[model samples]
Target: MLSGAALSRFRKNLMGWFAEYQRDLPWRRTRDPYRVWLSEIMLQQTRVAAAIPYYERFLERFPGVEALARAPQEEVLRLWAGLGYYSRARNLAEAAQEIVAKHNGVFPSEPADALALPGIGAYTAAAILSIVYQKKLAVLDGNVARVIARLYAVRGDLRANGTWQKLQATAGHLLAGRSPGDWNQAMMELGATLCTPRSPQCLLCPVSEFCEARKQGLTDLIPVKRSKRSTVELTLASLVLLDPRGQTLLLAPPAPARKSAAANDVHTLVSRMWHFPSVAVLQGQAAEALRKFAEESLFRGRGFRLEFFALKKVRHAVTFRAITIFPFRARVAKLPRVSASKAFPLADLSTVAVSNLTRKVARAALALN
Candidate 1:
């Protein structure tokens, strides 16, 4: 805990650093709540460089809360396709609708009110209130938390409830400037750029003198992270069926579940998007398992005969799961009468929304032709 005078000095030094070194991000350009909300949501679990283009494009399509509320779910999902986390896009659209109905298309200024909206957590609420409303509130995100932990040498389980409270209280204590938004961003920026998780740049840090971790030679160990779960490796086998006319088969979402447990699991992963019918299977029996899956779920007594040949393997990962997708190219003589599969020209994949894994499957299948 810094004394009042020491805290004041810290704030002045941090603010000075921010003035000289803060990167120009689009979200920093305006105090508009909508743009701030959009950028914040897009930045979740995504890097700044990756989120910028998507942020610009999303705003261009849905300029305001009313526009986002009126846009179809598919259209929003299409724009957010390659962004990975589909749940964030869904919540963004849902929150827009809630704002239009509940707040009359205006963003809430109060942190409490802002938190009531879907997907708006404490950090987001604080950021919005401080940045947009200029409230003297502190922001405690991952970066800020790490910075705070190191500055105070706050060890032990940070995920513990009491530990987090201490961190938040300390953050509030240090937020001394008149412009809380700039101060909060400055702390986070320092963490992101200088106090990185691995090999922090303490020499260039503006407030290194105050960092207990640096003084104690424990910068790398101050902010303890929660242990990750064991990685699960899976072998996914997918059938790339093409009709005699040569359009590749793709199943639309809400596709009925298959009997195979492996296929059902993969189907759940992509419950709301289009993809080739795929199943996780034993490496030794991948071809036979996919053939059985295609016959039962994809063909469905439509007299469509699947003649498939196994393609090269495509590797991909989703968080803790590492997957190697084995694609099999098949020729179909007839179309399914009861299946949800639709044939699309391989050249027109960009026109529709799909997962990154599905794109890899498409690429692997196309290479065969």
Candidate 2:
């Protein structure tokens, strides 16, 4: 419970430190609500360095809400290829379309309006309203959560609803009225750079003097995390079905189950990009199973010579599945029309939204070709 001159001192110290030490990210260069909103959405569940290229590419393509609204979903997904969490891309496009229709192509300045946008939650809404619109809203993200938990030496599981309420109240109390945007960014910057999860640089922290966890010599242990669940390993045989001309097949992922809407839709992963026909390997020999699945699913009973040219193995980590992908490539002498349409020339692999595992397979296949 920070109060009086102590709270003021804390805010001053944090903001001053942020002004000097904050990283000069591209997203921080603009005060445009649309740009800020896009960056915030992209950065969710994504690293800053990784998000930069995607952000730049997306902005270059869409430029504004109207452009984003009009752009095709496939193009948006292609731009968001390497960045996981495909639903963000989908929802962002939907939200953009809605903004264009409802708000005259302008992002709403109010937090509640921003919150109404698809995939825009409390943190995102606060961030956009504060930073872009300069609204007096407090933004609480993972970084702020860690910062608050450590500062107050909060001992409860952070996932608990009560803990979140407490954290929100604490964050709201600490926000400075004049520069709420700077204050919010400052807190996030501090947590990202100095108050890190594993080995926090307490000596360099701006508000070290006020941090209860540091004073109590519990900086490492203050923000307790919920226990992690075990991951399920899945073996996937990814067929890199390439025609003689070098095109690949791709399928749209099926809609997610009602209960697991947040989880990655495997159907979308395959459907969104051009890749060799693939199948899940439940049991039996890998090569035989892959060939049989391709014949039935991809070839569709068409008679085309199956040439097993290259086999490459790649591993990818999804939220719940540790997937091992085995990529197999074969070139047919009489390239079927079906293969020709589905296949992409081995040279233009970057144009598609293939998964990292499939990308690895493509690289290997290209080298072999």
Give the whole-model CA lDDT for all candidates, comma-separated: 0.82, 0.78
Give each model a TM-score: 0.92, 0.92
Q: What is the C-alpha lDDT profile of model 1 across 52-162, one tens digit per residue?
A: 999999989998889999988778888898888777887889899999998889889877779999889988888878888888889888898899989889888786878
TM-score of 1: 0.92
The whole-model C-alpha lDDT of candidate 1 against the native structure comes to 0.82
Which regions in candidate 1 have their CA more than 4 angstroms from the true location?
244-246, 255-264, 302-304, 333-335
